[model samples]
Every structure is written in C-alpha cells, then in structure tokens.
Target: MSLREVIAQMRQTMASLGGEAAVLLQRLAARAIRGELRRLAGAGSRVWTPAAARAVVDRLRRMLVRLVAQLGAALGKALTSAAATSLADAALFFETGDRALLGHVLPLRPVAPTPAQIALAREGVFKASLGRFGALLVHAVEGAAVATVLLGKPHRAGVDHVALALRRTAAAHAWELQRIAETEASAAYNAAQLEVLLAQDVPGDRMMKRLVATFDSRTGRDSVLLHGQVRPVREPFFDSHRGHFYMAPPNRPNDRELMVGHRPAWGEVVVDRWPVAEDRRAAPAPAATRRVPGQAIRSAKNLRAGDVLAAPGRPRIASVAERGGRIEVRTEQGLLLYFAAGAAIGVLAAS
Candidate 1:
C-alpha cells in the first residue's frame, strides 16, 4: 500500500477513539515516519543503511512505551489491568529488534487507600510478615532459596510489574515488624511503671499522677516540664527522649514561673517521667496571650522533641503549667504530635 493510504487509514482509525486518540495517533504517526525514513534512505545516493533505520525505529518504540506506561500507572490499578492488552499492542507497533521489545512491559501502580484502609492494610502487612518470617526462618536454616529471596531487598524482574510488587511487599514487612516491636516494648514499660507506682510512699492519687507524668516524658510530650532530676535511660523507639524523673519535669527557661504556679487539672498520663494532660482545660488556668497565625517562632536552642526536659533532680517531667517562657505540654501515648507556633499551649478562648 502507498504511504498516503497508510497515513489515511491511521488517521481514520485514530478519529474513532475518544479522549486519548490524539496521543495514540501521535504514536502511530511516529511509527509511520520511522518506516518512511527507512524507505527513503535506501532510494538516493545518500541512502541510509538498513541497520541505521532499524535503530531509529527501535529507539522511537522504546520511548513511546515508556510514555504510555508512565501515564497509565497514574490512572490507578484497575486502568493498568484494563489497558494491559492495549499497552502490549502499543509496544509491538514499532518492532525493529528484540532489545526494544523487551523494554516495553509497563509497571503497574498500587491502588491508594483511605486512612482506615491504610490501617487495615498495615494490619494485613503485619500478619503477612509475621507469617512469612515464622514460616521462612526455619527454612533459611535448612538453606531454602525462597527464604533468602523473601528476606532480601527488592530485585528486578523481567516485567517491571513484578519488581514493583516485590518492593511494596518488602516495605510492608519492614513497617509491620517495627509496629510489633513497639507493642512489645510498651507492654514491658507498663509493667515496670506499675511496680514503681506500687513501691512509692506517696498517696494513690499522687502515685497515679507521677505515673502519668513519667509516661508523657518518654512519649512525644516534649513540652512537659521535669521538676526534679530526670536522666536518660534505655532508648525507646517511639520516644525522642527517654528518662526517669525524681521530682517533676523542668519548665522552659523563660516560662518556669507561669508553669510552676498553674496546677495540673487532672494530673497527667506517664510514659516514663513525662506527664500528659488529661484535658488541656481540666485544671483551669488564667486566659493567656494567644499566638497569631503565620508567626514564626524559634525552637528551644538545646532541646528537641524527644529530649528529656527535667528539673534539677527529677527523673521525669514535672506537672508545671509554665516554666521559663515555654509551656509544658503532656501528650498521650502513641499519638504523633506536631508542635507549631500557634499550637504550643492549647489554651483556646474559654467558651
């Protein structure tokens, strides 16, 4: 058939499709041009070599496949599956050699989940990792190849889809293992705290307050004060700082007076020596200056979110309202807290 006929046929076929017809036509047009160039080069004295034409066609085909795969993967898992055949057909359009053909297989993307879906996914990941690790460890000792592959980092496969899947599976296992370790660690922590509380000479209410405070210190309660001497102990995965307090967590250098005067409303929850607030408003304090939006505040020079903030001799954070210029903040266990300029002291306008 004539080149014009081929071009006309391609145009008619492309016009029939909706949406992505333009992109598809472009690919077809590229293939046609490559073929035409191959024909023209052999005609004149300055004729192109067969190998050169074949190479050009091959490179164009590889580029076209890469473009399609990148775009299709973003459309979600269902589109990837549905367009699998079309993707394969597009790959075969400009077949000049085996090497280019080999590179056209598209990688599929995993479907994203909602927050609840992610939680469920994480649970499933944990179960799968636990099951795989338990079952495979025994085989690893016996020199099973499968065991090695499962434990190893991601590897490339003939198809990009296979490699992508393996990477995701490995990631899931790592995350689940981390979560399991944290749960076991938390259980051990609670048992130790229980023993400490029972042995203390303080009243039951006071002992409970101390326990809550200790828990807060070890968790993400960076703003809590350590009234006495608190020192770092064993490192905890979740805590930025780990320490035990003899008295109370220290207040920030500038906010010490305000925190010392304000009493905790319902005491605090303890991680190690830090005290987490039961409710910001549980024990009422005077209305304070509200931070303005978009204001930039400098972080404590020496302290970080996980560092143990302690008073002179305390092992945990003290239940103080304001120490120095910084507000004492106590957070609940397992919650990730992000501190910003306006969010530091949670004293909202009393309604």
Candidate 2:
C-alpha cells in the first residue's frame, strides 16, 4: 500500500491500544522523528530509511495528541479544563522524553579524523545509518497510535483506517526487529544450540536426568534447571529480585495465575501469556521427549540452547556455554558450575 495508507492505518491501531501504553507510544514517536531528521541530513536520502520512518511516526503521534485534545474540546462539559490541561502536559512529556531518548539511549559517536576528514566523514555516515533504524521503530509506533485514536472505531468500508495504520506500523516494526535479530543472531543462536546438544550427549554417574533452561526476552537474562523435566505453568510465576529475568504472568486483575492445560515446568521456557483464559484443555506435548514436571528421565542428545523448554512456562533457553564436553552454566542463584555431557535430555521447544 501507499505511505499515506500505512500512516492512516497506524493511527487507528494506537487509538485502540488505549491506557498508558498509548501515551508511551506517542512519546516515542516524537523522539523517532528527531532521530530520523538527523539521519536524513547526514545521508542526503529521501527514502524511508529508519530516519524517514521515524519522521512519519512523529507526524502520527502529534496528530493523535491533537485528536485527543479535539475530542475533549468537543465533549465540552464532559471533559473539564483540568483534564485537557493534564492531557496537554502528557503530550509535552512525550516530546521531552523523546529528546532525552535521542540524547541518552541513542547518542551519535564521534570518530577520529584519520586521513584528514575522510575517515571522520565515513564514520559519521556509518553512525547515522546504524542509528536511524531504532529511531524509525520509535516513530512508527507513536504515529500509528495517534492516527488510530483520531480515526476512532473501524467501519464496514473494509478495515478501520486507524487500526489498519497501527497494524501496518506495528507489523513493519516487528518485521524489522525480527530481521535484525535473525540476521545477526540466528546463526550464532543455532550454533550455540548444537553445542548444547553435544554437551548433553555424554554419559556418567552425577549426570543430570533432565536439562532445563530459562530465559527472559525483555532483559535478555537467563537461568537453567540443570536436571529438570519440562512442566506446564500451573503455579504463580514469581518475579526475580536480581532483575536479570521477569516472571510475572502478564497482568490479571484476579491474581489467578493463567492456567490452561498442564502446568509449565519449573524453570521451563514457555510463552508468557497473561490473563487466565476460558479454556483449560491441554494440547499434546511436543515431540522433544520431555518428562512431566517432577518426573525423572534418562539422557538424550537433541536438546539445545535457544530451543524453548516450554509447556506452560516462562519461555527460556539453556543459557549456558557448552565448551569442550561440559555445559558451563550459571544457576538462578547466580552461581556458576559445570555439568557432565551425558546428563541432558532432548528439549521441548515452542512448536
């Protein structure tokens, strides 16, 4: 679709993503635009580089905030002047925070001027190219939210203009992030998985019956349950104090842990879904030969790091190095140790 269509869709999506999240998206959009502008001046390109994307996002965000203001004004007594004033303050915060993100989270690095100004110039170009994509993500989400809010609900004339805008923007950002992750880490993550399997192939006494791994996507921190079977999540997943990993099962007002099917194994890596679902049926377990929670198992060689050891659990990986024949691992307690190669069983990943 055209750029204008994409922008329109993004705005609708943001409107639906209400609450504090909408505000956050708007804030990021502002930052994204500034970052984009900086890159454009450096590259002399009109194409939607990360910087250009950020610019589009910023436009969407400003428009969303304006829409909110307009709605409040139209509502008249429905919205007090105090409420409007607060919303305006919120908009202002979004802008200021965006600037801070640019300055702190993504700052341009200066390169030494070698061969006079040529090396410096090259460095500048590289920095702008590398840094602009992040800015674009910020822009896309923020802009889409604004557009979505302004457009209001969807209509029968095909898609809701605002929702479509937000979805497209979100899809674009998600695709970009996934692409970067795959390009940079896919091979490495795969290789690491292989090494883990090999380490689990060894045989001996003191060998762990089940090899369990845990990980957090947000902070990129991890833990391992060296000899545990994969279990489904049935109990409360507590948050770790070390801040290395998170386990709060989304946000559910009822305080009931989201339980559907078999419980996730302790330290197993499962997709962290929040809000207890209506259904409680359990699907057939994955083919990876995982024991039910609390069951003991023999050794298998197919397990790998990054492969999800999940059932109803925190989506985790065997976050350890398989150097030589041993699995050098760090436990949840922050203690480092080595496990024999033959102790590990195959892994149960998210299919």
Candidate 3:
C-alpha cells in the first residue's frame, strides 16, 4: 500500500479510539480548569457553582479539539520515522494524561520511574541489546574466521578481545538507550505537561487532582492490610509530588508487581496486577513492636538463622539469615530489611 494510504488508515484507526481518548482528555481539561477557577476564587473555597461547571464543560469541549489535532500531528510524525513507532503506539494506546508523549498535549502527570521502574527499563535495554548485538557478533566472528583461513595468515594465537569490545559497547549502548527511554517515556513528557499547564496560568500542582489507585494487590507484611482482603488508596499510593508514587519491589524491578498511585483513566476494574498500590502503609515509621513488646534489639550480633522476630508497625521478621556479610531480616511481607553489625534496629523478639 502507498504511504499515504497507510497514514490514512492509521488516522482512521486513531479516530475510532478518539471517543475513548476524548472522554479522558476532556475530563482532564475540566479538572485542570476547575482547579484553576477554584484557586482564582481565593481562600481554598469548597463551593461549586453552575457557572463554574459550565466553564469546566466548555474547557472539556476544547480538550476534544486539542486531542484530534494532537492525534493528527503525532501520527504523521510517528509513521514518518521508524524509531518513533513504539512511542506512537504507546501514546495512542494509553489515551491518558499519564502518557509521556513527546507532544506534551495534556497536563496531569505523575512522577517518573521509581527505582523499580528504572531497573525494569534497564532490563529492557539489556534484552534489546542482546537481540541486536548478539546477531552482529555472530556475523563478525564468522567473517574473522573466514579471513584468517582464506589469507593463510598466521594464527594470531592471542586474545583478540573483539568479543570483549562488542560486549562493552553493548553495555554502553544499553545504558544510553535506557537513559533515553526514561526521558522520552516519562521525564520529558511530565515536564512538558506541567510546563503547558503553568503557561496557561493554572495552578499546575492542584489541577493534578486525581491520584489513581484502588484497594488491590497482595501487599507483603510490610504494607497496610487491605480490608480483610484489601483497603482504600488514600494512605498508600497518593503522593504530594507528581500526584502519586510508584513502588516496585526492592529486590528487582519487574513489571508484574509494580505499585502505582493512580487509577485507570477510564475507570474500569483492572484484571492485570502489573500496576498496583502496594503501599504496605510503607513501613509505618517503624516504631515499637506491638506483637512482642520490648523485644527490639540493637545489634545484629545475636541474630541467627531460623530465628523469628517481631517489631512494631512492621511485619514479623519471618526469619533471620546471613547475607552479604549482614543480617538479612526477612519480613512476613516479603521484605528484606538488612541490618549491619552494631546497627540500632527496632525491638525484635524471636516470634
């Protein structure tokens, strides 16, 4: 098919999803405008008037228009280049203010990758490097072998280090790609979104009104107990900065158990647990151990494997083990709280 036809079809496909995007984008605009109006009225008034509602509705209408234009421009650019295909697909699919599209069309944005996200992204970079560089290495090795045999050249009988060079180059490339992806996928868009909001004379922080997340996920012993099964989101995911926080497990940042502070843009019940609010009430300030009071210990000297311990506001230390020359306290919540020798830790009594 002609490139023109491809672009046309792409535009049509985007249009079909435009309704969904419109609903989300318009809601976002209404929120931003309402936030501005509220602030302009001074003294944090909680009042809502019909006039204000109309104003928000009007902004919503404008948002739909902006979305259409954004789609047209973005699709055009994405198809025009090969590298941008991923970003285009990403931006189109999300249809939320959270998307870090280079276009910077919407306002509300959460903070970028948590440490967990960074790790996952690095993994992605490494995988991408393996696929691209691994193949190149095979061909290069074959070429070198062929050249050596064909030329009747003396076997260098030395460590050529070609593989090492490629490996190091791959590592460098992986790092650079990861850094680029983080910025393009998150930081740049977040900053641009906030910039646009501020330039439009709105209170950027306040208009970032929604902190999505719900009662979900198996937050290890370290997190707040959700109901008997789950709990509300307010205490766990919501963040004063970037609107919400995302937590990934400390061990390794994988996509499966991401902790995010936001909800779905369209308000659907999520089946995927990839992004959750594993607030775990986030280690509730580690005070006294309610389960076994006065058991808190000061040093790792007495800790031993298979020793069960308890601490207030923390999950019971399910077990103690030596790891990396330190005492690793494995919490019931699946957290690895490491204590160094002679370090002061909360009271801990063998459970």
User: Across residues 76-191, which tens digit of lDDT does each residue of candidate 3 receive?
Assistant: 23222311232343233334323432323443343343323333333443345324533443444334333333333222211122223323443444433333222222322222
Sorted by lDDT (best first), the order is 3, 2, 1
Q: Candidate 1, which segments miss by more than 4 Å at Cα?
A: 1-168, 171-173, 199-343
The 0-to-1 C-alpha lDDT of every candidate, in the order given, reads 0.28, 0.31, 0.33
Model 3: CA > 4 A from native: 1-159, 168-176, 202-351
Worst 10 residues of 2 by lDDT: 254-263
Ranking by TM-score: 3, 1, 2
Task: Give the Cα RMSD of candidate 3.
Answer: 25.4
**Distance (Å) between predicted and true CA of 174, model 2?**
5.8
Q: What is the per-residue lDDT of model 1 for residues 1-351, given as tens digits with 9 covering 90 to 100?
A: 322232233222222221132233334434543453344334333223333333433443344344334323222222222123222222232221122334333222222332233223224423443455333322222232222334332222111222233334433444333333333222222222222323332332232222122222232333332222121112111112222222221221111110111012223322222222334333333234345453222333322333323222222222324343433434223222222222223121111
Q: Which lDDT value does model 2 have at 82?
A: 19
- RMSD in order of candidates: 28.8, 21.8, 25.4
Position 72, candidate 2: lDDT: 27
TM-score of each: 0.22, 0.19, 0.22
